[model samples]
Target: MKWSEICIHTTEEAIEPVTNILYEAGAGGVVIEDSQDLQQTFLSDEGSEYSLDPADYPIDGVNVKAYLPVNSFLGETVEEIKQSVNSLLLYDIDLGDGRLTFSEHNEEEWATAWKKYYKPVSVGEHFYIVPTWENFDPEDPNRKVIELDPGMAFGTGTHPTTVLCIEALETHMSKKAEVLDVGTGTGVLAIAAAKLGARKVHAVDLDQVAVQSAKINVKLNKVQDVVTVSRNNLSDNVKGQYAIVVANLLAELVIRLAEGGVADLLQKDGLLIASGIIRPKKEQVKEALIKSGLHVIEEMDSGDWIALVAEKAE
Candidate 1:
């Protein structure tokens, strides 16, 4: 039940790289701590700015906070952990939550606390998300349903980015279309596509845990036959063109993939739905998609989150 926190102090420039390394090293979750989070942790409640001199913080740029359950097989020996931690010479490591001046807490205990925040959420008229421990009376047997226990994958149907992608899929998917969900965080989008009548759905992610979690959610939805999960990027190993391609990833990655000829994997008239785009970077992604021979077909927004649906030029 104990949760071990690994705090990596690195310049803002290296935080992402360090995050990637630590993630590969077996951390369950990697949180990039921005100045805002730091301010909130130390200054927010005081109704005043942080009084500490900026130099006191490893505030050269940013910090990475990773969380792992103590009972999980993240790593055993301090030597083993240090060897991985030491790989980042430019960064410092704190084995506990150094940011919060408080006692450590158990995650298994926190897991129960987190459940109180979860409630049945509806994505659209035809679909409803039911937590594994909750029950729902189906108003219609044909209504699409997805049961999920979001252990640790990114998409939980809560974030604006996720909902925007779902809305984009709903706008374009047809009963006979094949769907390819890139970066399928909890397989939520792919499952929704299948229930929305996608003939076949292929879901992929670079994280093994995400892949496994997607599989679990797909099984829970009883859509295993239509949803195929894999741990791979869309680079070269992926095959065939899909009628609908969904990539709910960071804006930069989405832009790169769109321009990097990944659109060639889409059918001539296929739809490409991309989300996880911050407000500021939207224009860059739109330009990239245009340069990649796609025309913007639709745009959906939820709060500051945005989703773009483009079609490969016929």
Candidate 2:
């Protein structure tokens, strides 16, 4: 069988959302080729022949490639993906090269080739993100394992956005508290909150697929008793004030939530950890938070991404 390899040349800031678009479009598998990977040191087995070739990377941005079966609906599917990607510009998201190209391959050529690129990584001080198929026994007692079968949904805490959020949680969570994880893709942050001794965690996502995926991962982490996964739009009609509210969403969504009274959902002196923001867009998000009655107390940066921690202001 033939497969269509759809490639999107986009900014690093757009990777998470773009990947979600592809997965939502029924991608068989996704491969992210970032130019910065050439500079970062990675873990590998002593006898492994794995090495990144310069030729396979884009010199400036990122290449998000997804494999799909060649079929009658291929043309429409590609069009829809293009439209969805183009719509990001409406919210001030940079499209970078904004170029897309397609190539054909045999089913066997890419069916499992991308799996080799995914390996266990330590995302934060306390959490180790392990792919479900891999075996991991942490040597550090403080290091807890989160086994993920990420399938189509993202946020296994490997991405810088999720990593920043997890790190922020680790630093701010000094005592048990009730947590609200907005845009809880794969339930990574909610699971992190649970691991950090959150008395209760409400993990909500707008996407049903993400909700289901989060539910599975939450159970896989055995935090089911502490975390509840549900389907809900971003901060809409979310009841009860939380001790901590973490929103890992786009800058526009963050602003919208902030304006929509996300601060009102926080208890007095509660923290709002906002992430999934590009460095360029941090100011606008911070302004939105402050305007919504929250004071930005801390900011974390990783590559071109930024995460902001804010507290309820008087």
Candidate 3:
């Protein structure tokens, strides 16, 4: 079988969001060729055999490549992916040159190539993010493991934004609490909530692919009984008040959701965990939450990303 390899030239700051765009467009795996990777110290020979051609990498930015099957809808899919990546600008994310290119390759060439980049990662204190292909045994018996294969969904539970959300959840999640995870890509936050003893979790994503992916991950984590994955835009279709509402979305989207009344979806004094926000937009998102009748209680930062924890006004 033939595959279309889509390569996006973007900055490191845009990597997570751009890769997420490809994932949402049904790219099964992604390979990142960052110029910085060449300078990093190697701990093992795992990636030594993989040829790193300087010609294939950008001198000033990173190149993210994803494989999509060559099919009738390939053109439309690629266009949609480009549009989604471009939309990152609304969140003030830098895309560098924003050059996108593609080539045709054999399916066998990329089938296992992306796996080298994924490894077991510890998210919060008690949660470990383990890829499906990795065999990991936690040294701490009290640690909970979330086994995941991202497939075409976004959240890998490794990005700093996701790590902030998971850590926030760990601190605010109450036993038997009813949680709502908006934009629940791969259902990572929802699964975490369930594992943390939430009585019920409503995981919703606007992307159908994400909804399906979340369902699979929820079941894989053995939390299907506690988590319900569905397709919904923001909190549009979500009913009832939640003890906690978590959204790992762009700063712009978070503001829109906040203005559209995210506080209405939360119970009084309930917590809201908003992530996927860049440092520059941190105050903007906080103001939006405050205007929506929520008060910022805590702020967490990792690199250039920030996550805000808020509580509904009494």
Candidate 4:
């Protein structure tokens, strides 16, 4: 089998939003690239580092690939796939007839390709990220370990959202506090909260795939007894309040939850840690928090992403 690489070149401002659109349209996955990355990886040898200009990087969009069946698709059929991706992309590429080619990998090989990116990382003093397949020897045995694997999930502790949440946990999480992790992709944040001494942790994701992935991750890390996994929408079967609620979702979803979901799930004076906010939408989320009666305690940034630590009004 084989695959085609569809490269979309758009103004630097439209990447993530465009990527989401493509994903909704049936993209198997996406690879985000800017001219700099493209130049380094394909055209030059500099390889991902150069004079930094924020605007030079694509901010508001993404490129996506629609995988076609390599077995049955002829070159002409492949061209149709290109057209499909290209139509959604709204960018120009010079693939002579706009036909790109790819070689398909067996499932094992494809999975292994992503496995190479997983490694152990320490997100905080007491919290460590260890991929399920990797061996992690913590420098201090007393430190807490959070096992994770990206397998079909979005986080393995490398993304800005994951890092920001770790920073939030380091700064404000309290011993014996109950934690609620909304959109707990791979359960990374919940595991971190558990390691930080949260007495109980409840994690939920709308994707059934994510729910299974998170459950496997929690068990892989030996935190199954402390971390509960559920396949429900954020507000679905969840009742009762928690001392700390962590939500790493799109800026819009974060704002909505800040006003409604978090407002109901958080105990008075409880803490809310939210990320997945782009720089442009930071103020929107801040305003939402205030509207929901949460007072901002602190805010931090990782690249263009922002995390806000807020407290429910006492």
Query: Which residue pairs overlap in candidate 1's backbone?
Result: 12-61, 12-62
Summarize candidate 4's per-residue lDDT along 1-314 as a digit string, tens digits: 34443445453234434444434444454454333332221101221223334443454333323333344434665455445545643432121222233555444444354454345655656665667776556665666767776665555665656778888888888899999999898888888888778899999988776788898888887788889999877655689899999988877778768756577788878989988777877888899999888889898986666889999886
Residue-level lDDT tens digits of model 3 in 151-180: 777657776778889999889888999999
Q: In candidate 1, what are the lDDT values of residues 245-310, reduced to their tens digit?
A: 899887767877886787788998998999877666789889999999999988887555678999
Q: Which stretches of candidate 2 lie over 4 Å from their true place?
A: 37-57
- Candidate 1: residue 286 Cα off by (Å): 0.6
Each candidate structure's TM-score, on Cα atoms with residue i matched to residue i, is 0.72, 0.92, 0.84, 0.74
TM-score of model 1 vs. true structure: 0.72
Which prediction has more favorable TM-score, 3 or 4?
3
How many clashes (backbone N, Cα, C below 3 Å) per candidate?
A: 2, 0, 0, 12
Task: State model 3's lDDT.
Answer: 0.84
Q: Per TM-score, what order, best first?
A: 2, 3, 4, 1
Model 1 stretches with alpha carbons more than 4 Å out: 4-103, 138-143
TM-score result, candidate 3: 0.84
Instruction: For each candidate in turn, give its C-alpha RMSD to the true structure in angstroms.
Output: 8.8, 2.4, 4.4, 7.3
Q: Which digits, one per residue and each the tens of the lDDT, describe model 2 over residues 35-145?
A: 866654433432122456688778878999999899999999999999999998886789897899999999888977776656667667887777787655665557888
